[model samples]
Target: MNITVKLFATFRAGRFDIESRTYAEGTTVGDVVRELNLSEKELGIMLVNSRHVKLDHRLEEGDTLSLFPLLGGG
Candidate 1:
């Protein structure tokens, strides 16, 4: 299965063009993040098909997912 991912902030450092990636079927958002060697704190937000989703959210083929970093302002 394939999924489109949009990386933001620190996550964008290693990649370009918020492109699509291929993964095994039944993979969850959390699985990919870990496989990518990213930490939970680095995954500030997870959006699935335009809605906020938890790490447990299972991904489907062709699903669009976005990951954002934690924002802090005083």
Candidate 2:
């Protein structure tokens, strides 16, 4: 299946703001995270097709996944 991933804030540094990636069936959000070389601790909010989802959530074809890092500023 193919999904679009959107990275926000510092997550976009050295990476793309948005990109389309292909995954096998039954792929979970965590699988995508790992493929992106991102740790679970670096994940703040996750959304699949505009709905909040857990790392274990399964992805569907044509779904858009958005990942945000935990933000902090003085």
Candidate 3:
């Protein structure tokens, strides 16, 4: 199965450009997040198909996943 992956902010700056990944069915968002070695502090929002989803959410083929960094500034 294949899913689209999108990275924003520092994540993109980190050179995580593959944009997508192919994994076996039943793969969870947390699985991919861990594979990328991204820490919770580096991850802001997670969306699947435009809906906010949790790390444990199961990903399906053709799912579009977007990751963003936490915005911080005074």
Give the best candidate by TM-score: 2
Number of clashing pairs per prediction, in order: 0, 0, 0
TM-score per candidate: 0.89, 0.92, 0.88
Q: Which portions of model 1 show Cα errors greater than 4 Å?
A: none
lDDT of 2 at 12: 88
Task: Indicate the residue-level lDDT of 49 in model 3.
Answer: 92
Clashing pairs in 1: none
With a 3 Å backbone cut-off (N, CA, C), the pairs that clash in candidate 2 are none
Candidate 2 residues 1-74, lDDT tens each? 99999999888888899999999999999998898888788789999999999999999999999999986668
RMSD to native, candidate 1: 1.2
Provide the overall lDDT of each model, using Cα atoms, as 2-decimal numbers.
Answer: 0.86, 0.93, 0.86
Better of 1 and 3 by lDDT: 1
Candidate number that wins on TM-score, 2 or 3: 2
